[model samples]
Target: MAKSNKPIVWGLFAAGGTVCAFVIPVMILITGVLLPLGLFGPPEASYESMTRIVSNPVVKIVLFGILFLALWHAAHRLRITVHDFGIRNDQLVARAVYGFAGLFSLIALVTLLSF
Candidate 1:
């Protein structure tokens, strides 16, 4: 029998896809549509509330998870898309896409923690 890492990648892909499909859109709506429209509160109040949201450790972790999963999901999608576009070098493509994902994920974690 042979072991492969496909299961792990596929697991993250599935979970990330679910997160991207569901949570990310709502995030866009809240941050994009509602925030600018003053639906959350007065502008100053919203800014203070948002600052408070990031200062809390729990929210930071949640944001990290959302960002990390989204980045992973997009990287996987881009890898597949590049292959579909006739890029025959799988190893190189895999490393590039996943490398960028990892780098950005680390950046996201650091940025979140800084708050």
Candidate 2:
């Protein structure tokens, strides 16, 4: 008998899903809810509001974390969908898809932060 790492993989996935689901909705809420409500100081504070919210070091870190996790999650689910549809040579396809997903996600993150 041998101890295996399968459970660890599954646990990591569960954690990722749980955290993304929770954090993503909150991110949406803050952007969607408070922005409309003008609760982030004032209605005139449009760019000011965004700069205030995103300028915090902690918020930048968290946004980057969420963006990467979201891309990884999307890539994984899309890979499975391709596999489940009986696409031929799915493992090879999954690898290519994920590699591009990661590369593009990094590019997008960099582009976003430059603004």
Candidate 3:
């Protein structure tokens, strides 16, 4: 039996999909729906407040993880989708998608670290 690294990528995909399914909707509800509708008093939606919230190291790490995983998840999906569409060049597609994800992940990490 040949061992493969597919499990690691699949794990990331699952985690990201879970986050997208659960957390992203709530985030949209809070920031997109609730905040705009003034559901809560004075709308804790100020730029300063947001800055403060993300300033915490733990928060930064969490956000970065979510963003990173989501990017990888999307990239993997895209790779599979292109393959399904008969691109016929799995290696090139995989590299392009994963490279894009990696570049963005690095950017996200750097931005989070800066904050």
Best by lDDT: 1
Relative to the true structure, how large is the alpha-carbon lDDT of every model? 0.90, 0.73, 0.86
> What is candidate 2's lDDT per residue for 11-52, written digit by digit as tens?
545666777888888878887897778777676668786867
Candidate 2 lDDT score relative to the true structure: 0.73
What tens-digit string does per-residue lDDT give for candidate 3 at 1-115?
9999999999999988888887888888988998677765464446667778778999998888888888899999999999789798999999999999999999989877876
Candidate 1 lDDT over 22-96, as tens digits, reads 898889999999999999799889989999989999999888898888888888889999989999898899999
Which residue pairs show backbone clashes in model 1? none
Ten-residue stretch with the least lDDT total in model 2: 6-15
| Clash number by candidate, in order | 0, 0, 0
Off by over 4 Å in 2: 1-12, 29-44, 108-115
In candidate 3, which residue pairs get closer than 3 Å at backbone N, Cα or C atoms, i.e. clash?
none
Please report the TM-score between candidate 2 and the true structure: 0.63
Ranking by lDDT: 1, 3, 2
Query: In model 1, which regions exceed 4 Å deviation?
Result: 36-47
Off by over 4 Å in 3: 29-45
**Residue 1 C-alpha lDDT in model 1:** 67
Using all chains and alpha carbons, the TM-scores for the candidates as numbered come to: 0.83, 0.63, 0.79
Q: In what order do the candidates fall by TM-score, top score first?
A: 1, 3, 2
